[model samples]
Target: MTAEHGPGASDIDESRIPSWIACEDLLVKMREELIDRAIKLLNREIESGHIAVNGSTLFSSEANADVEEAMYLINNLIDDSGRLHKEYSEYIEKNNGKKLSDAEAKKFGELQKFVLSVEQLNMLMEYARVLSSWADAAGKMIEGKDTEDILRKTIDKEELRKTVLEFFINDSECRVLLSSKEIEAIKSVLGA
Candidate 1:
C-alpha cells in the first residue's frame, strides 16, 4: 500500500506516479464520480426551477447576452473538468497495479486538487444562477414601481450589480483553466 500524503502537503508532483498506482486510480475515479454528481446536481436544480432565468423587464437583450456568455463559460468549465477526469482515469487504468514514484504520487494529488477546484467552481455557478434570478425579479419589481423609489428602497443595487460582474469574472477564470482559446472567446463576448 502507498502512504497517503497529509492534506497540508502541497508539493506533490502530479507528473510522477506515486508508489501505489491503485490508490491513484481510485482517486481519479473518485474525482470523476464527484464531477458526475455535481453535473447531476446542476441539472436537477435547473429542472426544478431552483436555478432559472425569470422573465422580467430587467432581462434586457444586452443583459441576456451577458448572462448567456456566463452560461457558456460555466458549460465549458464543466466539459473541461469532465474531460480531464476521463483522461486522468485512462492514464491510471493503462498502468494499473504498477508502483509509482513520489513524483507520480504528487501528480495524482494535484489532479485531485484540480477536481476539488472544479467542484467549487460549479458551486459558484449555482450562486450566479441565483443572482441572475434575483436580478430578473428585481427588474420586474422596478418596472411596476418608481425607479427612484425602487433604487432607494433597495439597499444595494450597486452591490447586486457588482455581484453579477464578479460571477462573470469567476466564470472567465474557469474557462481560462480549460484553454486560452476559450478565454479569448469569453473575452470577445464580453467585449473585454
Candidate 2:
C-alpha cells in the first residue's frame, strides 16, 4: 500500500498529521461555533413549531429533558476529542518530535482520524434538534401572558439576569436560548 491509498496503509508522516495543539484549537472553535449556530437555529425552530428528534414527538417537558441530555452528550464528545488531541500533543512532545514508531503512528493516526471525523460531522444539525426540543419545553413552561411567576419558578432569576448581562457585555450574536415570546416574558420578569 502507499500513502496515496489512504491513512494507515503506509508510513504515517508525523508532519502531515495536524499538531495536537492545532487540532485542539480547531475542535474548540468548531464546538463553540456549532453550538452557537445550533442554539440560534433551535430557538427559531421552536418558535416556528418545528423541532428535531429521533423521529418521535415528545411532550414539551420530555423533549426539553431529552434535548438537555443531547446537549450534554455532544459537549462530552467534544471535550473527549479535545483531550485526545492533548494526549497526542504530549506523546509527540515526549518524543521530542522524533518520527513515531509504527505502533505509535497507528495509534495516533487513529486518533487523528477520529478527531477529524468528529469535526466533519455537522454537529450543528444534531444540536439544533436537541436544543430545539429543550427550548420548546422551556418555552411552553414559560409561555403565558403573565409569566412573571412562572419565569421565576422555571429558572433562576439572577442567573437569567446575569446571562442577559453577559450576553450584552460580550456582544454575542447568537440568539437567546428561548423563543422570542418566551424571551420577552423573561425580560419582563428580569427587567432586562
Candidate 3:
C-alpha cells in the first residue's frame, strides 16, 4: 500500500476540507493528522502479520524504491515547472501593456494551474519530510537518546514561517482563497 492508503485517507469529500489558502496552522494540523493516521496504520501492520519485523525497524525495500521513484518524478516536475513559469513570465512581460489574446490567456491559465499543482506537491513533500524527522527524533528521545542536535537542525521555525508567508504573498490565486482574518494573521506574523 502507498503512504496515502491508510485509514481516513485523502479520498475524503472535497467539500468538507478547508480551502487551499486556509491559515497555515490549519493546513499543518490537517497534514499532521494524516501523517499520524498513516503512522498508526504502519504500527498496526507491523504488529499484525502484514509487515514482517526482523528485529530492526525498516520499511520494505519495495516501499523504499517507490519513494525513490516518487522523489525522482517530483524533482523533475519541479525543474520543468520552474522553467515553464520563467518562460511564461517572460512571454507576458514582452506584452508591454498589451492584453493577452484569448488563446494566450487560456494557455497562461493552464500554466498557472500546473505551477500551482507543483507548488502544492512541493509543500506536501516538505511537510512529510519535516514530520518524519520529528517523529524519528521523538522516538529517539523516548529511548533516552540525545536528540537535541537533530531537533535543533530540523526545526527552524522562523525560516518555515517566512517561507509560508512568502508563498501566500506570491500566489494570488491561493491568497484569494484565504479569509481576511487568515491574511491579517499572516501579515502580523510577518510584521507587515
lDDT of each: 0.44, 0.43, 0.47
Q: Which residue pairs show backbone clashes in model 2?
A: none
RMSD of each: 22.6, 20.6, 15.3
Question: Candidate 2 vs. truth: CA RMSD?
Answer: 20.6
Q: Across residues 22-129, which tens digit of lDDT does each residue of candidate 2 receive?
A: 222222332355565545544444344433334443445764775565555455555565675577667645765568899977766655554444443334544433
Tens digit of per-residue lDDT, candidate 1, span 12-106: 23236331332223223323333444555555545654345445433347856645544554576666767866876677566556677889776
Q: What shift in Å separates residue 123 of candidate 2 from its native position after superposition?
A: 12
Q: How well is each residue in 89-164 modelled by candidate 3, as lDDT tens digits?
A: 6865675466889987776665555545555555655655554444443333332212222233334564763565
Clashes of 2: 0
Winning candidate number (TM-score): 3
Candidate 2 stretches with Cα past 4 Å from truth are 1-79, 88-143, 147-149, 156-172, 175-184, 189-191
The candidate 1 region of ten consecutive residues with least summed lDDT is 1-10
